[model samples]
Target: MHAEVGDTVVVHGRTVGTTDRRGTVVEARGSDGPYLVKFDDGHESLVFPGPDVSVEARA
Candidate 1:
């Protein structure tokens, strides 16, 4: 996956009863690697997301 700053990342819940989460890509690590995301909850994480994640461009 590829993303840049200002992009929105959506992480689908891993199991039932869990809610999906959305975050903004605050930092792009490399051409194809991990990314730093600031979640809606005010938490930040360096995520190496899998197929369950989707990126929405910032237009």
Candidate 2:
């Protein structure tokens, strides 16, 4: 549930027919998310991820 800048965030589809979303953490707020993410589609949004979200560490 925690993420940092440069890390990747995966938002799994919670329901059938919905595709997964992948984005990079543009601005991290530690555990206080509603993080700023830049998606692969060239859009940005503030997302407060839930249990369906996974934060992958930057390597």
Candidate 3:
């Protein structure tokens, strides 16, 4: 998926009973990214999205 800055990234839990993680794309690298995301829980990290991740537009 193509993600831009200000987009919301949802990292779904792979297994049952696990909570999904929500974060915003603070920085988007071109192509298959190593995106910089700032999570709602107040931390920042670089994420490479996979099948388990979904991207949403900032609303």
Candidate 4:
């Protein structure tokens, strides 16, 4: 639930047709990383992680 800047956030898909979303951790806000996500749909969003989301540190 806690992540730093430059981390990678992946929205795990439960179904096969459900595509996974990937975004870079642009800024850290509150206890989690409020990610600046760029999707293939040509849109971006600032998201705060919920309990179901998974976060990976940038190497």
Among these predictions, the greatest lDDT belongs to: 3
If candidate 4 were superposed on the true structure by all CA atoms, what would the RMSD be? 2.4
Question: Clashes in candidate 2: how many?
Answer: 0
lDDT of 2 by residue, 1-59 (tens): 78888999998998999999999999976576979999989899998978888988999
TM-score for candidate 3: 0.90
- Models 1 onward score TM values of 0.92, 0.87, 0.90, 0.70
Positional deviation of residue 48's Cα in model 3 after best superposition, in angstroms: 0.4
**What RMSD value applies to candidate 2?**
1.3
Error of 1 at 58 (Å): 0.6
Cα error, candidate 3, residue 16 (Å): 1.4
lDDT of 1 by residue, 1-59 (tens): 88989999999998999899999999999976499999999999987869889999899
Q: Which portions of model 4 show Cα errors greater than 4 Å?
A: 14-16, 38-42
What lDDT does model 1 reach?
0.90
The residue ranges of model 3 lying beyond 4 angstroms of the native Cα positions read none
Better candidate by lDDT, 2 or 3: 3
Q: Estimate the overall C-alpha local distance difference test score of candidate 2.
A: 0.89
lDDT of each: 0.90, 0.89, 0.91, 0.73
Q: Candidate 3, residue 50: CA error in Å? A: 0.4
- Candidate 4 has its poorest 10 consecutive residues by lDDT at 32-41
TM-score of 1: 0.92
Return the lDDT, model 4, position 9: 79
